[model samples]
Target: MASRYHEVYQSWKHDPLGFWKTAAEEIDWVSTGEKVFDPDQGQYGRWYPDWECNTCYNCLDRHVEHGRPGQPALIYDSPITGRTASYTYSELLEEVEAMACVLADHGLVKGDRAIIYMPMIPQAVMAMLACARLGVIHSVVFGGFAANELATRIDDATPKSIIAASCGLEPGRVIAYKPLIDQAIDIARHKPDSCLVFQREELAADLKPGRDHDLGALQAEAVVAGRRIAPVPVKATDPLYILYTSGTTGQPKGVVRDNGGHMVALKWSMKYLYDIQPGEVFWAASDVGWVVGHSYICYAPLLHGCTTVVFEGKPVGTPDAGTFWRVISDHNVVSLFTAPTAFRAIRKEDPAGAFIQQYDLSQFRSLFLAGERADPETVNWAIDQLQVPVIDHWWQTETGWCIVGNPVGLGLLPVKPGSPTVPMPGYDVQVLDDAGHPLGANTLGNIVVQLPLPPGSFPTLWNADKRFFDAYLAEFPGYYKTADAGVIDDDGYLSIMARTDDIINVAGHRLSTGGMEEVLATHPDVAECAVIGIADKLKGQLPCGFVVLKAGVDRSHEEIEKELIKLVRDKIGPVAAFKIAITVDRLPKTRSGKILRGTMRQIADGETWKMPATIDDPAILDEITEALKTHGISV
Candidate 1:
């Protein structure tokens, strides 16, 4: 295994195109064709049409054929109900076959789409794989989204059916997901033909009047038939999924991706970036909805034929913040991939030895941090507390897996406090100015992908190919504009500063407004908050925070400001402890729950904000302006 990995590494380092082509041949393709690059094709220039492979075949059948059918493929845990389950590869295949048979029984055939609004459970994974097996594109929405948001995605996809769980577990709550699904279906102008419901906490009291099917009944009824739905013939470019990205207007962008490309990208990523081994149990703590989970947790690990842990609950549950450690102990996970937000949350609840000692994490070999920025404090905290190398990676929904990462030790050459490390092999990443000229090392500029979009990069926007290209490609010719501000240090290590819209340089140290907001929200009294760095003489720029207290909680100005600073220090580091952290009544956020940091920045910098017509709460801006003046931070 080591020798093969070495060959892959050397080949990739020396000749990326040749290495990827060789890796491409590892999978059984439907056809063999070669068109890796074509500059004239513009945004959609790179197409590999000569190859074809179903994700299920690569993830399941191939592994089973290699004499590893009985190996455990998945382990799941639900903290709320205290339930646990496990599935071996063969057993998982059986579940997928059974679910596929059920779908086929309902006349849903190949080329159909299925929207899965289910919780993090074995059934959810099964349904997804079953859709893959049946050649039905699956789009999964986050279970916590409001009904309107859910309806928009469902409408966009126009799926034939929805596989939903009755309920799901969050921190200290059991969310009724089925009811949400019902509400969405009612609000949806275009509804699916059927609904497959899984009962976890409580059965739906009022089922939407339609072709409502109980998952348990269907599984039980189909088990005796011993039938498997025949796999469909799929091309490499056939749409495999339509992952909806959150949009500012609540209308999500359906990120359509192909099966073969996703397989190639994810397989290579897990093998190279994460060094995934067959027997290893990989645990990416992100929910299945996000891009990270879609790649690492669900698709990537399976594509590599490895065991994975899928927790059907949140990281922080009751019993005083020892939930994640307990899950790791129970599952004996070897690798953990989680967000910096989760790690910070754990630290906020308990930053001592007893909580850390409650579980055995010695089995872990690597820990990956994504879904947000990883500053020095978070990195050092993981290293000191968990005693494992924390790999901080940078990527987006469009780029797919860790295009830039510090691969275990070989790439972990040196650590920069806020840098996201170097780009991985096969990625030609660059930082360029607005005029498309490459910027010098250590010069902050727009991050751009110099090469064509790689595998797992969205094949196209659903019904909006022109819009997709115009948004990503038209901004810069022959490059994919990342819209992220970054800097390549003198040492050639890549450090992502922040989103260009929200980044602020304070004392020469670039900070993400999102990162500061996350830290401020750590205060017990703060229910929500936003932060923006305003101009300052001494520091160049300093952060000014706007905080919203939890209902029925009263906090004084000095107390809130002090707590916010301390929270930033404790969660991140002293560098994040800004000199001007203040509290406000509310913040200006987009309809999709993202804070309008640009507007806040303007407000902090003493500039008038031209409120857009769609501002959800225009009054919030006035409140923020008044509060800042009241706090005596106004210019």
Candidate 2:
């Protein structure tokens, strides 16, 4: 089917407020006030500031009241514990009501902040919805974050209550969360009033006498009392949640998501952007800690009246590479959204996709990849294996939804292997040079979205409007600087090549490490790869590549390294000066699967650097350093 993306985009371009106001009606708004947008409200204006709504009501009660009470609303699948649970819309609303009553009984009120630190469980979703029910602004720090890192968020958000769990499970290990929460509370200057701890069967926690409360025990008590709390109405512009960006240092910065616009945008995305409809099973196989989990996993699916999966397992090693397929097949999932790193991992384990054949994916319609630039090799590999339209979309934590994507429902545009397709309805994406001048089609330049960034994007940093302006808006004047370097083709497809910092200069020529990584991915034996610009005395900077080979590849590493160097030189030209390809076990990545390229560059240049708070494993950096040492390039 041919896409009407151009028609819809033009409509949005012609009248942004009218487009959003029409979309806003899809949600069950408490009061759809007159002003669709107020341009003078914040750093770059505000969306639906006067509109009043309850995010929790749209996600839960509305579906139940509209004769869909028996439909499944949330599914909890935990391969680690071999446990599965499903909740109907009515059942989920009951649980959220009980939890909200518990919170209200403990004196949590509208606008008071709460922090949720829990694993991927039914309780975590309940906590978030319950907070939303009472208009408490909640912040979710990823389960198992370091004590000091959690402390930084505790100081920043300064929640009055904390909802957490005892432990989080990995394939071969159990991460104790209670101790980390305790330690964070100890380190932070601001102390939360109470801590609600959920005890997993694998590991129980020791609750503090005065302040700590058992979550299960309190929730049971609330249910016994028949406490049913109604969803509190809040101004559309009032904050729904605060999500601290994953890869950060020093002081933690929290991006605030507004209740009204967040509901309007995500609900619209479910039908138009994702093309999944009501009552279908939609699974975003991401942890609730990140933005993907917040929007797709927790909020969007529920708002759209779809059953959302809360998966507690890895892409592999939870059982095997077949776990993902099993979950999709078992749940009758129609759409699956995950990061590209997951597919690469599965591809590395089962290159032939033999595990995929063991399950029936007749109901699965499409696969969406994000969280990083989806290299063409990985994208093509997924297309071949799944025989589904593998879409590569791009967005960020601040935006809360897609900036550039293929509107699968509006009808997908022609697939471009590397580009994320094009800017979505709300974004006016452009490529601009250093001086803030617009660049022509297909020119490598800074990617900026012309402000005011549509509904659902963060308006400002929590409690730091000046810092938000300085960090995002001040640099580009009227545009919100994405800080990513990319090219928009003549057809308007946006190709995210790298972060602005990742664009390196070789002699006098600007080059993209992402472009080189794409070339390296084409190598048959390379399972995963990363490219960084290393400092060089003669050329100012030289390209350095690292690769991890596929399983059962018996070819010599030296031979593959030589091929990779030639592949980049041939594909990107000699101006890249591509040299130094090293074979490593893995590339350093954040917990969310973003390669730590900037950190790798810092190490190669012998610059002092602190350990990233979001590093997947601190030990990976040691492996990277040793691999660099072999190539005579180390700090």
Q: Judging by TM-score against the true structure, name the best candidate.
A: 2
Lowest-lDDT window of 10 residues in candidate 1? 1-10
CA-lDDT, candidates in order: 0.73, 0.93
Question: Worst lDDT window (10 residues) for model 2?
Answer: 245-254
TM-score of candidate 2 relative to the true fold: 0.99
For model 2, the superposed segments whose C-alpha errors exceed 4 Å read none
Q: In candidate 1, how many clashes are counted?
A: 1
Model 2 lDDT per residue over 1-635, tens place:
88999999999999999999999989888887778999999988999978889999999999998989999999999999999999999999998999998889778999999999999999999999999999999999999999999998999998999999999998889999999999999999999999999888999999999899988888988888888998999999999999998654467789999999999999999999999989999999998999999999999999999999999999989899999999999999999999999998999999999999999999999999999999999999999999999999999999999999999999988999999999998999999999999999989999999999999999999999998999999889989999999999988889999999889999999999899999999999988988888899999999899898998999888988998888888988988999899999888988888889889988888888889988889999999888888888757
Cα distance off (Å), candidate 2, residue 559? 1.2
**lDDT of each residue in 218-285, candidate 1, tens digit only:** 87677667877656768777778888876544356788878776788788777667867877889988
Model 2 pairs whose backbones collide: none
Candidate 1 stretches greater than 4 Å from native: 1-15, 34-42, 409-412, 504-530, 533-542, 546-579, 583-635
Q: How far is candidate 1 from the true structure (C-alpha RMSD, Å)?
A: 5.6
